[model samples]
Structures are given as structure tokens and as C-alpha cells.
Target: MKGLYLALAALLVAVNCEAKEPPTQVVYRFDDHRSLELKGWDCDGELWYTDTQKGIHSQVWSQFYRIFTKKFIHPSERYMAISSWGGGFTVSKDYGKTWSGAHYSPGENEPNGDNRPPYDDILSFTVVGDQGFLQTKHRLYMSSKPFDDPRILPGGPGIHYELEDGVKGDIQSGSAGWAWGLIYMTRQGLKGTIQELQTSWKDLPDKTPEVKGYTGWDHMRCDMDLGK
Candidate 1:
């Protein structure tokens, strides 16, 4: 009887230990010095993270972020990433018990995304199921990935008639899940031309007096460090 009681006590202790275990963490750093993290947490189809006080947190509305990324954590649910202090990010698949992977927000993720040039501090997004839009440091991209992972939008469809006969432009779309009218380095109050998705430079509009970049912008629900 004594041995049986000891076994029960041990089992209870083990369960308690598991319940109190801390969450995992993931962080990212960018050349632009914008960094962020993701702590595995969730709430109401949204991602929960740690704030300045280091307390667990979640967004008042994560659906808006769904337009871009699917990594939002739900309340009290097991997540693989979370946010951090001093405005950074982190990630961990094991729920904050441990963590790995970091990145700089609005950093370059080229040869894998759209034609718009690289930009920074992309923190706002909106997604609906498999269709959504993402606003990063430079510009917005489109995708149809799971709520946990979304892809970038492609360029418009057609040819640059002004160019050589056989030359072609990138595939751009206006679909909701894959439609992003705004782009990086675009001159405010002026419109720029869309070339191939692989080009690096853009011709400024005639009326604009030197285009400004990332002027007066902010976002939420992104890893911040690695998410951009």
C-alpha cells in the first residue's frame, strides 16, 4: 500500500512539472537593425506573445494580420514562437521551453518573393484562410499558404511593349489574397512603372521630389525579427 501511494505522488509531481514548464523562444536580426522575436503562444486564432513587462500577450485582433502571415498564436495554445522586449522577436516549436531561428524585420527574402525591392519594419498584415496580403518593410506581397505560412505576391501580367519584342514582365495580380497595390520605394503622390520581378532599381516619377521610404508606418502580430 505504501509503494502504491508513493507511485501516485510521483505521477502527480510529474504532471505538475510539465504544466509549469516555460515556453520556447525565437528571434531574428536584420541588417537594417530592425529585430524581433516570437514566443510560442496562441489565442482565438491569433498569436500570443510577451510584451515589455515580459508578460504573456496577444493581439486584440489577429485576423487583420492573417492577410500576410499565418504564424499568429492563439491564447494559451501551444505555439512555436512569440514576441519580445525592446521591440524584437523569437520562435520555438516546442512552446518556449527552448528556442531557435531569428531574423531582421523588413529584411530581404529575395529570389523567393515578388518584384518589389526590399524594405523594412513590416509588422502589419491581413489574411483570410489561404488567401491574403502581406505588408513588409519594402512593399506588400500576396500568398495562399496556411494561416501559419503565407507566400509573396507576384508581379503584374503582360509585357513592357516599350522594351524589345520578346521581353516579358513579371506576373502581377489584383486578386484579394494576392493583391497588393502598394510597393516599396514607390514615390508618394506619384506612380512608378512595374518592370520584371527580378529588377533591383526603379525609375522615380517626374513630379516627385526624391521618393522617401518607410515614412510614418508601424505594424503588429509579426515576429518582427524574422517575420519580415
Candidate 2:
């Protein structure tokens, strides 16, 4: 009888230990030089972009603009999209070591003084479900297979093209499958919006209404905690 009790207690302790272990987390770290550098861990907990020479090609590192990752169509398949400072975009089926460029051309609509490829200088890009979305100053584009072709998403005029009063905008995606549209301070106030991409964007209600009295705002690098 004592032996049976001891075995039951050991089993309970083993279950408790397993329950106390934390789940794996995906982390993204960004650094900026002339362009931007991004490194992260995938769901497997393997560190990506660690190799200096073989991690990312030289051209990609120098002109890197932004990098986005998502579990698009398949929950098991992770996809990464990277854009350039000048104009083009690329995709990595694996975590970002290798890439296949997108065949997009802005042509006559290309921004002035941006000498890189026409498809490179993306203002914001993200993947929601099976669809990938890209926003330039002028248009919003969507694609399923991003490397093949991307078409313009309707309702471009409804979207805010640029930040008001010289403010900057950063678009980030949440693991819950929503995009957070964060705008820096403007003449009016600091604004934030949430977009599901099913409909147009909407303003997120101000949480701290009591806090006020800022004249102007400049860009600042701050860490964002994306909670599961």
C-alpha cells in the first residue's frame, strides 16, 4: 500500500512539472543602420539570421527596409516577407536566409529619387491568413502567391496615405491576426487604429484621456510587448 501511494505521488509530481514548463515564444529583434536589420526565432525555437555571411545576402542587408512573418494559409507553414529601402520585395519560405524576389513594377508611378527597384520601397507590408498586403504611398496591394503577382486592393482613397502634420506611421501585425496601425504624435494628438483587413481601419479609443499637453513629437525606438 505504501509503494502504491508513492508511485501515485511521483506521477502527480511529473504532471505538475510538465504543466509548469513555459511554452515556446517567437521573438523578433530589430536594429537600424543606414537601412534596417531584423532577427527572430521561429516556432521551433531555432534562432534565425544568426550567420553574418550566409544568414542574409550582402545586398539584402544593405537595402533592407522591413521584415514581416506570419503563419498564413497553413498553420504549420511560416512565411517571411522582406522589403527594400528603395522599392522591391522578397519572400523566404524558410526563415529569411534565402529569398525569391517579387515581380512587381511601379513603373511611371515610382517615387522620385528612389533609385532602387520599382517594387522595393514599400511603406508597409503584412500577411493576414492566406493574403499578403502591401502599402505604398499611393496604393494598397494584395496577393496570395506574392512572388507571382499582386493586385491593387480596392478602396485606396479611403486609406490614410501619409501621416498628418509630419508624423510617422508604423504598421505591426499581432499574433491574433490583426494589424495595429500606430501613428506618431500629430498636431491633434497621438493616434492609434486597429484593422482586421475585412473592412476599413477604425480608431482605437484613447485609454489615457487624463494625460495631455504635448506640443510635438519625434520618432523614438521603443520595445513593444506582443502578448499571447
Candidates in order, TM-scores: namely 0.26, 0.29
Candidate 2 regions exceeding 4 Å error are 1-77, 105-123, 145-228
What value does the lDDT take at residue 72 in candidate 2?
A: 14
lDDT of each: 0.32, 0.33
Q: Tell me how far candidate 2 lies from the true structure as C-alpha RMSD in angstroms.
A: 20.3
lDDT, residue 119, model 1? 28
Look at candidate 2 and give me any clashing residue pairs.
Answer: 86-121, 87-119, 87-120, 87-121, 88-119, 88-120
Q: Model 1: per-residue lDDT, tens digit, 1-228?
A: 999999999999889866763332323221132223333333113333333333434332232112223222122222232333222233433323444433332323343533343324444433222222334555444321222111123443432234355655433334322122112222321122332222322332222122123321123333333311
